[model samples]
Target chain A: MNDEAACVLFDSGHRACGGCAAAMAARLILDAAGKDTIVVSSTGCMEVFSTPYPETAWGVPWIHSLFENNSAVASGVVASLKKQGRKEKVIALGGDGATFDIGMLCLSGAFERGHDFTYICYDNEAYMNTGIQRSGATPYDASTTTSPAGSCSFGNSRPKKDLPMILAAHGAPYVATASIAYPPDFKKKVEKAVNTPGPCYIQVHAPCCTGWGFEGEKTVAIGKLAIETGLWVNYEMENGVVTKVKKVVRKPVDDYLVGQKRFRHLFKPKRNDAEIAKIQALADRNAVKFGIDITLKK
Target chain B: MAIGTGCTARPGKSRNNKTGSWRVFRPEFINEKCTSCGMCRIICPEGCIGENEEGLPVPDYDYCKGCGLCAEECPSEAIEMKKEEK
Candidate 1:
């Protein structure tokens, strides 16, 4: 790798698909954490693709733990580092399946004990590693392998779990939601989480081009649309209190859902106005609940 | 080449695998139109794009899989993707 390319701790030339937002987020997080960092990844896309036996892409010290125990492993690493008086940052990386479902208990325990580490969940909204199955983080009415939209069904019937709020309920020092389209904001949150002296959680909205049924090049644009439509709100919380929220220009949720093939069934021969309206209501509720400013300034 | 788990001492053995042949489209950087914004370097999934002495982004084509992300995210439109000439 060249000098500039080597600056990022997450080395490239892995098996991630082109225009992968999760890959971009990983690079941003590593760049923010600097060299004195150790990463613990779960058994997911990030771990499987980045370290296939002998060929590892990470430049920093990295470890791969089981899908359900990365947070617990990271906690142990933090404890050992603390005992040795080392100041290296410990980051637990996982996808939504590991974070919101399988690993929730260990993550809660880690946060409850207030381990000095950062936990980043690359929320692609489903289990992309397992052929795009539905997870607890999958959005409502979105199609997935397990939650297919057929004649008798409309995809996932349950809403995405409010994981950040649950983490905040543990009294985490820092909690934030970010999207890959806003790199500066994402990097700043990562830096802040690493610098803070307790457990921190940052959930990043990483668009999955292949699983989400969008063109590869539209990853960034899709991420932006998610934020613009209030479908994915970006905000920060410190000590269980909301601090910052990214304002939106208030596009309809249809604008965000129409592009993805996952939502294609909702707009096939005719637009599912009722389902679209329900999705819109969810976004509107989020805008109001999070106090997202929808005012457009000239 | 069959090494036991936790026995192999050598790291990064996959460096021998050249992945450039996976490209369906290749990025062509236009020097004059380049503003050196460095966005392409930051956003490249493969991290194959680096800065030269002039601080312009240059792709190490040997590993670049022609993701076309550089072309898509470039504000200056300095990079264009052309069909790979097989």
Candidate 2:
């Protein structure tokens, strides 16, 4: 689909935040899948906000399934299509909470069964739909409603789950990590996933303006910072083998974290260099693992 | 409208819910400074901006929620955000 047509598929009249990364990602995903696609969305912010009672923004055949069963629903749809000898593509959509936490079991089962579908997880880092609570996808030291930073506690103590790698381990035909900062790269990955056979998983680093505590206009900028800092590495794995990686221009993690209110505690009153360093180390490790050239140029 | 488990309205019913009232700041387009790059129209959250005969963006203020995204992403600074006079 072209740019103009893509915009029409995911109507902007829906109630998304001023600069919603998930909304943009949805448009890109649907555009890649084209009109002959069936979308299955899990119960989350995207589902609730897009399809309120007596209104819908989606222009395709969309279904709202339980939070933990969207993948199962997509699998069923794929199976039905195959039985009927149809060529319609099935795309399963879910937020980080649903994909990494609630719906992980069903997703794993679908992947194991080698279902012909694409599961896209919009990783906004927390359970924004449930009032910004901490989830398995929340990065380390990030503050959330459930993981508030206090005198003794330092927000969320654990790191983000390696979701794409886990999906790759399942021997998915295609697995990728994408960011909303790069629209062309994201669009290409979605299209590739849609056309690839068997189970494909694409995790998109979607930033939430309200939940992440960033200015509405800074949504795309924040997403770029995440990629540049190597905190959100972009890579693709095919059949359990790494095939592609987006090299980062290496920046300190502080540049990415200091913009969002969720990480405000790390800089105010007294700068927690130790915590910041730990996060930076995580970025460094990610760059190395993904073969991203982070070497600073003189 | 009765609340249900799924979407009940005919598709595209969201167009009926004019969200312009939600805006606290409105984006004013400066046609002279615009290069007709269409970046604002592409990044606009409302997708209410359209090009006129001159290729300058003309926003449908009745549905725009004053997101200011157009002003922020505008490469030429052709769009400026002005506080709405409630």
Candidate 3:
């Protein structure tokens, strides 16, 4: 394939932190979507970085709206384009903070209305742009600015709200969870979402560097580590049945947490082994719940 | 500009069976600025920093999270964060 055509979707001048996984995900999805794509971005890191006033990293038609209205805006774009007889592909992207939290109503409305668009959530697990605040996508027991571990608290007390399930419940034709760590699988999912009729949603696990308190260069490594540890799983749902895309087996949660300072408190002497165990159990439960082959036990 | 060792680069593969197989990014240390201090080793979340036989800091990339804590905390600006090759 021509890399130049793919390269034009997102320019290198965007302001995302060094090695931002969302940038990589945006690049890959827009590459697969090709040149005739129109992207509607929410008020998140991707939006702020890619379209900073005088400069825009997006090569295709791009729009930025309120934090929670990216989906609705894209739906409007799709409607306007349809009315104008424009067949160009339409995509809406937002972080989990926007999609699962602030923008839930708008997103749900768009999905329920069955907008002919693809809504991709770059799930970095928090509102990284506005200073690593907790969102609905933040995993339980993980510390965030909003959920700092303290004398009286155990980090975020609630499990990450299952977003793909919510989208599936909206009767979306396609919904999938992807990670930048697994590119081929993510590409396939993107292609599927683009081709599927009606509304589609793909939540990509884009590991953050600056917000996660790690070096910018570890984007790809952290991406893979996330999936290996089951904190982020590569899976898809069609008609509400979840299926794991077994590119690799699950790994220990500690293997994923050791790199980021956000989880540093967990590793300290107070040693919330129960919290860590809960996270591991969540992974195990997902494996069993979704038929993921642990591919271990030797 | 090559930051770290690339001998075991995975190319298209994902898993590496060998121990210390995960991509190792060697941190660049400016000896003139380093004071034989241990801050780089202390802030390392992965516990990958080690002292060489001579007591200089060395990053064990096999377990190093690539978090760059050493680079951030170096008071003397001695550690330059470099990515180890795959």
How does each model score on TM-score?
0.96, 0.93, 0.76
Candidates, ranked, lDDT? 1, 2, 3
**Model 2: chain A TM-score against the true structure:** 0.98
Q: Give interface RMSD for all predictions.
A: 2.3, 2.3, 16.0
Give the residue spans of candidate 2 off by over 4 A: A294-298, B1-12, B52-55
- Which residue pairs show collisions in model 1? none
Give the per-residue lDDT of model 3 (tens digit) for A1-298: 3334554555444555545678668877876788888888889988886666555667788778898788889889999989999888888988989999999999999999999999999998898889989999998877899999877887888999998988999999889988876666788899889888799999998888877778765666787777777667688888677654654577788888888888888888666788889889988887776666545667
Clashes of 1: 0
Comparing candidate 1 with candidate 2, which one achieves the higher TM-score? 1
Model 1, A87-107: lDDT tens per residue? 999999999999999999999
Weakest 10 consecutive residues of candidate 1 chain A by summed lDDT? A1-10
What is the C-alpha interface RMSD of model 1? 2.3
The DockQ of each candidate is 0.54, 0.47, 0.02
In model 1, which runs have C-alpha deviations exceeding 4 angstroms? A1-8, B1-5
Best by lDDT: 1
lDDT of 2 at A260: 92
Candidate 2: residue A209 Cα off by (Å): 1.1
Q: What's the CA error at residue B63 for candidate 2, in Å?
A: 2.8
For candidate 2 chain A, the 10 contiguous residues with the lowest summed lDDT are: A1-10
